[model samples]
Target: MNGFLQEKPIKNFLQSMDEFFSNPFPNSAFPLTVKETTTANLIIAELPGINREQIQINVYDHHLTISVNYQELITEENTQQNFFRSSQTYKRNSRTVALPYPIDEKKVKASYQNGLLTVTVPKQKGKKIMIEES
Candidate 1:
């Protein structure tokens, strides 16, 4: 009975860890806010510890996408034993949002400051069509 109890707790712990790692954005590492105005749409994202070159923004039709790619490195060195160890890790994440109105690709603008990414997409002008009945 004791062995059974011990095994059950260990199994549950492992399962919980597996679920956590499998879920994307488990800790809300990437959060985004969108605001729409009469003339344009604005997107604000919080990306701490990331550089401007590591982020990519795309606007197509009514969709907006934000992608990030970065690398992390860890190094350990010991002079007495002459031992050195290094490890590199690469991480990539992306999020996409659908806007209510079509965007003007030529006028899209983005800026990053103080770990905040702001994107502005202007609304496309609509053309009116006239129908004539004969």
Candidate 2:
């Protein structure tokens, strides 16, 4: 019984690692939150050190996609008259979210401020269906 339990846990751990490595954008993943308002659905994404010009937002087939490409610069100075300069260039990341309710593609709007990306998708009004004789 003890051996069986240990084997199961190890198997589960290996499976989890495999799943993690299977993702293409493992390091690019960030935090996000979804919320629903009375009139629209809202998605807030936290993206620090990313410029607005480097971000793109798109809506297609009830899906919202956010893509970002940025460059990170690292500089180090040493007291022994040595300097190190390194930069990570053109790193790209994207995330897609499915909208719960239908939205007007033309009315979709997004704003970024203070490292927060806010996307508002206005809900589409559905026509009422009238039932006659069955």
Candidate 3:
């Protein structure tokens, strides 16, 4: 009982903190970090255990949403008792980000690789500029 059982609370607290910082969108959504540049806006989110084909990306008006569905097949195998237990469930998660300005839908692009989803929404020319004459 002295090996590692005393650190359960500490481990749980650290995990909670990690989840808080890992996601930038609403608490219910997947997690995304947005970086703004002079040329374009980059949105990055990690969707582990999700395949590229099961992901959906959409850009509408000034909002960007990415969704991924994961099918979990949990199997418990007992070799000693020669028995097996299987459970299947599907989890769906989607994250939406609001942009500072609207963009041309046709100019948007997205790429998914290595369990990482990258959504790039290029800033439309003069999209964020407001003209004021003195």
Compare the candidates by lDDT and give the number of the best one.
1
Candidate 1 residues lying further than 4 Å off, grouped into runs, are: 1-29, 100-102, 131-134
Model 2 is weakest, by summed lDDT over 10 consecutive residues, at: 82-91
Cα lDDT tens digits, model 1, 14-120, are 78888888885564448899898888888999998899999998878889999998788999999999999999998778889898778777889999999999999
For model 1, state the Cα shift of residue 14 in Å. 20
| Poorest 10 consecutive residues by lDDT, candidate 3 | 22-31
Please, what are the lDDT tens digits per residue for candidate 3 over residues 1-134? 54463498877877888887876454366668999888899999987767788898877888888888778799999999999999999877888889878867798888888877887788876536788999
Please give the distance, in angstroms, between residue 103's alpha carbon in candidate 3 and its true position after superposition: 2.6
* RMSD after CA superposition, every candidate: 5.0, 8.1, 6.7
Answer with 2 or 3, whichever has the higher TM-score: 2
lDDT tens per residue, model 2, 25-114 = 567667788898888889899998788998998878788888887677776668687766666666778888997656567898899999
Report the number of the highest-TM-score candidate: 1
Clash-forming residue pairs, model 2: none
Clashing pairs in 3: none
What is the RMSD, in Å, between candidate 3 and the native fold over all Cα?
6.7
Better model by lDDT: candidate 2 vs candidate 3: 2
